[model samples]
Target chain A: AQTVTQSQPEMSVQEAETVTLSCTYDTSESDYYLFWYKQPPSRQMILVIRQEAYKQQNATENRFSVNFQKAAKSFSLKISDSQLGDAAMYFCAYTNQAGTALIFGKGTTLSVSS
Target chain B: DVKVTQSSRYLVKRTGEKVFLECVQDMDHENMFWYRQDPGLGLRLIYFSYDVKMKEKGDIPEGYSVSREKKERFSLILESASTNQTSMYLCASRYAGTGTYEQYFGPGTRLTVT
Candidate 1:
């Protein structure tokens, strides 16, 4: 069984600054996928970024990127130029090679201050 | 754009009542999932369906059943609602294709069992 852990329960970042949310997972499988998701007060889950375990290079979206360290079993999310809209609960997830349902972390509530 | 919609945004039910939560997707995805989210716990998969009339149990399938009579609609049922079952229920769908591991989610339905 794979388990994702987000040690931080709450985080705050000033507007236009950068923030990093930590995540770690335990899995024996060599082929897998890691993902970051955001949930706002609307309760809608949105995809932030994704990283393939086989890929050595990290994945970057508009303002969201992931530091995926396969050897360390760590996958952290970095949000640059953070805005008020980035204030939400962030979750880290893992999926097996078979594309099964994802296992998610407890989540880190990010509060972007103006 | 993929769109998943839940039947309700909020629901209130009493103990022992039978509750049904409906989910529909417009993307014609082959896989649909139901998950529950709590404050300290991340999203836990309750049930998933790969195709019509085919369902699979997830990590936490107890006290929950699902129906997928049609390809676009999936429904979750609580045979006997309990206070412990009260949480934000989320529905998601994903297209199983080459390199597609991201799942699109709907605005969750917050269920309160009293």
Candidate 2:
């Protein structure tokens, strides 16, 4: 069984600043995928970024990036030039090569202050 | 663009009532999943299907059942809805592949049971 953990329950970032949300997971599978998802007030889940466990390089998507440390079992999400629209609940998820379901973290509430 | 649509955005039901949540995906995805989101519990997978008519139980499948008679449709059912089952339900789907693949999600259905 794989378990994702997001230690921070809530986080706040000033507008135009940068913020990092931490995530860690426990999985015995060598081949896997890591993902970050955002859910806004509309209750729609949106994919933020993704990282392949085999790739040593981190994944970046515009203002959203991931710091994936496979050895440490850590995958953190970083948001740069944060705006008010970035205020949402962020979740970290994991999926293995066995075609199994995704395991998700508790989530971190990001409050972007103006 | 891939679209996963839920039948309802909000629903209210009483305890012991049978509840059904429908989800349809237009991307011809091979995998469909149902999850429940709670305040601090993140998203817990209740059921998933890899192909039509094939269902698998996930982490929290105690009170939930699922049906996938068609490739594009997946349904989640609660035999006897309870107050504790009142939460946001999400539906997601992904293409079948060995490597990393992103899952597309639908706007969640918020179910309130009294």
Candidate 3:
């Protein structure tokens, strides 16, 4: 069974700064995908970024990027120049090569302080 | 732009009542999913459909059922609602193609079973 773990239950960051949320997963499969999703107070879950397990290069979308270390089973999310709008519950997810349903970690609630 | 819509933003139902939650997607997606989100538990998949009239059980499928009579619509049903079933229900859809690991989510329905 694949399992994802997000160590931080709650994270606090300042506006215009940077914050990193740690996530680790256990999986035996070689080919899979990792993702970060943000759920705001509006109850909308938005895709922040994703990383392909086979890709050596990390995936970055605007100010959000992932440090995907497949060897260590560590996939962390880095938010550079964090904004107040970044305050939300962020989730780490995994899916296999066949595009099965995502397995998510316990979310980390990010609080952005001005 | 992928648009996924849930029938309600909030729903309150009594215990033992039959509840139905509707989800519709406009992207012609081949897969639809139902997930329940709880604090410290993350998002647990309840059910999923790969195609119309096809359904599969997920990690926590107990006390829940699904119907997918049409390609773009998926419904989650609670045969006998319980207080433990009170949580945020999220609906998602994805394409069954390359680079389609990302699932688009709708604004969730917060179901409260009293």
Candidate 4:
């Protein structure tokens, strides 16, 4: 069985500042995918960024990027130039090669203050 | 764009009532998933379907049932709803056998049981 853990339950970042949310996982599978998703007040799950276990380079999407350390089983999300719209519940997820449903962490609630 | 839609945004039911939550994806995805999101629990998979007429129990399927009679639609059922089941229900769909492993999610249905 695989499990993801998000140690931070809440976080606050000033507008235009940077924030990083920590995530860790336990999985025996060597081939897997890691993802970060954001859920806003609308209750929609939105994909933030993704990183493959085999990729040594981190993945970045505009302001959202991931620091993936496959050896440590750690995948963290960094929000650069954070805005008020970034306020949401962020979740870290894991999926193996079997294409099963994602294993999600408890989540971190981020609040961007202007 | 892949679109997944849930039948309802919010629902209210009484304990022991039969509840059905419907999900539909327009991209003809081969896999659909149902999950329950709770405070401090993140998202827990309840059921998933890989193909038409094929359903699999996920991490938590104790009081839940699912049906997938078509490729684009998946249904989650609670034979007897309980207050413990009151939470945000999310539906997701993914393409078949892909390394991308990106799952499109619905807006979620917030179910409140009294």
- Local accuracy of candidate 3 as per-residue lDDT tens digits, B1-114: 999999999999999999999999999999999999998999999999999999999999999999999999999999999999999999999998888499999999999999
Q: Please list the C-alpha lDDT of all candidates, in the order they appear.
A: 0.94, 0.94, 0.96, 0.94
Task: Decide which is better by DockQ, 2 or 4.
Answer: 4
DockQ of each: 0.86, 0.85, 0.86, 0.87
Error of 3 at B96 (Å): 0.9
The DockQ of predicted model 4 stands at: 0.87
Candidate maximizing DockQ? 4
Q: What does candidate 2 score on TM? A: 0.97
User: Residue B11 CA error for candidate 3 (Å)?
Assistant: 0.4
Q: Give all TM-scores, in the order shown.
A: 0.98, 0.97, 0.98, 0.98
In terms of lDDT, the best-performing candidate is 3
Q: Which stretches of candidate 1 lie over 4 Å from their true place?
A: none
* Residue-wise C-alpha lDDT for candidate 4, range A1-114, written one tens digit per residue: 899999999999999999999999999999999999999977689999989888899999999998898889999999999999999999999999887889999999999898
Candidate 4: regions farther than 4 A off: none
Model 3, position A35: C-alpha lDDT score: 94
Reference-based lDDT, residue B81, model 1: 98
Q: On residues B1-114, what C-alpha lDDT tens digit does candidate 2 reach at each position?
A: 999999999999999999999999999999999999999999999999999999999889998999999999999999999999999999999998765678899999999999
